[model samples]
Target: MADGMLGYGTTVRIGRGATPTWTPLALLGDIEMPDEQADEVDVTHMQSPGRRKQFIAGLLDSGELSIPMNYIPGSASDTLCKAIKTSGEQVLVEITLPVPSGETAVPEVFSGFLKGYARTAPINDKMAATATFRLSEAVEP
Candidate 1:
């Protein structure tokens, strides 16, 4: 399912950290990036904190879920700058997952597994920089 079409009840797990592991719990269709207008703001600079907070707030507000920042990995500094340069006024967040062939419940299982992974996984500086979201339900379009 496409990220844009994900449902409100759908759960999402965003992969973050140095090891590319899942950490944050996110609702699939609930994620959003609200439009912001900042005069004289540099896209590169605005993309980091501004975009990150927008993403977090939108998802949390829509899904009514809370995710700890310590669990995610990946620095917003470089990534934000890169995203701004590439997308102009917008930032791109790419999500990839293994889609199960037969069972449609794979995404939900993945979400639960990710939550468990976050609970037991060790935190390191490298692993502390990424962002992850585990959604409430599997998205279906």
Candidate 2:
């Protein structure tokens, strides 16, 4: 397997609202890729012989996209904080990442809604907010 370009894993950005024009959503720390699960069923038994069996094609459960960033008092990312702080309904947002070894401009879009948001003020560090978005649906037609 070929190793990827240096710093490629750090490529991440987000956009807000329907038909969001992309933006360079900054990050203050590591970005966690959405966690996935491969559920399995036990199917070893009687007729033949004792054997272990399970399916790797388990349903891919929905995931949470948590973004933690330094809070700029008036930065674009602030929208994320506002999203969770107060809301009338689900707010649509878009998370983008480059296709591995491919063009950075054309990203893979994981569009969904903001599940929740929270802010933190560490005594000795810059104010920050962790935006947790639940990826519930695909936007591509």
Candidate 3:
């Protein structure tokens, strides 16, 4: 049996869609898919004898994409910090997962605005940065 690929083989890339493609940026240790779900509205019928009902959906709320990476000057974290500071701007994110069949698979895609960035200063470990993005618009790839 073949062993599965390790997490280290996964890659996270980001770009602004300026050069006709996504440009890989930053060395992220971990990346996550968006946590998104459908929205609903309550429409209980008064004649239904105290039964509550919810409509299927209205709009999907904004999802989040989280990334953790080593904090370095002029690195991915730095570039993300700059992006996050911008007002009302969204960026693109792609996560590539390696296949165990000895080939590269198509990378998953997402797009969202840079929402928040947190920096950690650890005394005994490598410093890191965590970024959160508010995702929207059928951004799955």
Q: Please give the distance, in angstroms, between residue 95's alpha carbon in candidate 3 and its true position after superposition.
A: 1.6
lDDT of 2 by residue, 90-137 (tens): 444444444555555444456556667677778898898777877764
Give every collision pair in model 2.
Answer: none
TM-score of 1: 0.20
Stretches of model 3 off by over 4 angstroms after superposition: 2-5, 18-21
Candidate number with the higher lDDT (1 or 3): 3
**TM-score, cand. 3 vs. native:** 0.78
TM-score of 2: 0.63
Write the residue-wise lDDT of candidate 3 on 7-63 in tens digits: 767777775755425656576776666667877766667665557564557677757
Model 3 gets an lDDT of 0.70
| CA-lDDT, candidates in order | 0.32, 0.60, 0.70
Candidate 1: misplaced stretches above 4 Å? Answer: 1-6, 24-31, 34-38, 41-141
* Best-first order by lDDT: 3, 2, 1
Model 1 C-alpha lDDT per residue in residues 1-141, reported as the tens digit of each score: 645433334343443333444433432222332223323423344557645433212222112122233333334432432333343331122334434447454332222112112222454442322223223433331
User: Which 10 residues in a row give candidate 3 its minimum summed lDDT?
Assistant: 16-25
CA shift at 74, candidate 2, in angstroms? 4.2
TM, every model: 0.20, 0.63, 0.78
